[model samples]
Target: MKLYEFERAPNPRRVRFFIAEKGIDLASIERIQIDIGGGENRAAEFRQMNPMGTVPVLELDDGTALSETMAICRYFEGNHPEPALLGQSVIEQATIEMWNRRMEFNLLLPVAMAFRHTTGHFSDRENVFPDYGSDCGQSAQRMFDFLNDHLADNDYIAGRQFSVADITAVVSIDFARVIKMRLDPDKHARLIDWHERISARPAASV
Candidate 1:
């Protein structure tokens, strides 16, 4: 198996976290670096695997390339159900997806837009222009407030058990700090505490 990854990207980090949590052997898995801003992923060679030219693509032993962070996460869940990252029951799976989607739209999307628009990280791509810097930033801040309130009662984003939803949310929250947006420790103690617990996980350092 092979993984096309980018060190500075959150999407790849999510996959790495899952692999670490699963105790998957990194030595057996080949890693190919994808230059996020250099059009390396968009090149003809890489595009044969992922038309979208995104990072964290998993190439199976059968020469199948899997894309999308959520889809890849689910694939790993199905293959390795011992840790059950996606969730064990139907309701648990649904809850995980629900929270994951919310986090992606409310937090991840905005963070990416802010980075791209403000920094012009991918200005060369015709479809990568910046138009949502202010909107994305505002929406992301609103999400922080919503998450802060929701996390007051729960230890994790989806529920009692740690699931892929927490993985997605944690990555987005951590990435937000790069844009000077984060859960205020004074204002959101519960959320801050939750993050601390998640951060302390042995897999996090991966």
Candidate 2:
């Protein structure tokens, strides 16, 4: 299998982190670098793999390509079952999925939209709407407050164990810094603690 990704990209980082957690042999999978800034993803050959022209694409040996971070992570989970990131049972899987979706929508998407719309990073390649950028940043801030409150009680985002939900949350929270949205130590002590614990994990360094 081959993974198309860009270093430092939040979405691709999610997949890299997942692969690391699963203890997958790095030698077994081929890694292809995509230069988003240089318009590499927009190229015709890359677009043929993913119409959205996005990174973190997993191309199977059969020549099938899978896009989207969570989707690619799901594929990895199914193939490498040990150290399960999703969950052991049906209920656990559902719970983890719930939290993952919540974090993706409430935190990740807003933070990304804010950066893409406000920053000059995508100005020449994509449409930039400043009005929506401001709104998205405000939305992400609200999510941070909500997550901080939730983390005050639970050690992990989904519940007791560290799951994919935690991965999604950590990546999103860290990536939000690109838009100048960050956790306030005084206001988000629990969240900060959780972040620190997760950051110390070996997979996080991947």
Best by TM-score: 2
Candidate 1 wrong stretches, greater than 4 Å: 127-131
Report the lDDT tens digits of candidate 2 across residue range 1-206: 99999987899989988999899866588999999999999999999999999998999999999999989998889988989999999999999999999999998899899999888588988889988998999999998889889987788999999999999999998898877787999898889999999999999987
Worst 10 residues of 2 by lDDT: 21-30
- What TM-score should be assigned to candidate 2? 0.96
Candidate 1 at residue 149, lDDT?
A: 90
State how far residue 7 of model 2 sits from its true place (Å).
Answer: 0.8
TM-score of each: 0.94, 0.96
* lDDT string, candidate 1, 174-195, tens digits: 8877877878877878888888
Q: What is every candidate's alpha-carbon RMSD to the true fold? A: 1.6, 1.2
After the best TM-score superposition of candidate 2, give how far the Cα of residue 94 lies from its true spot, in angstroms.
1.0
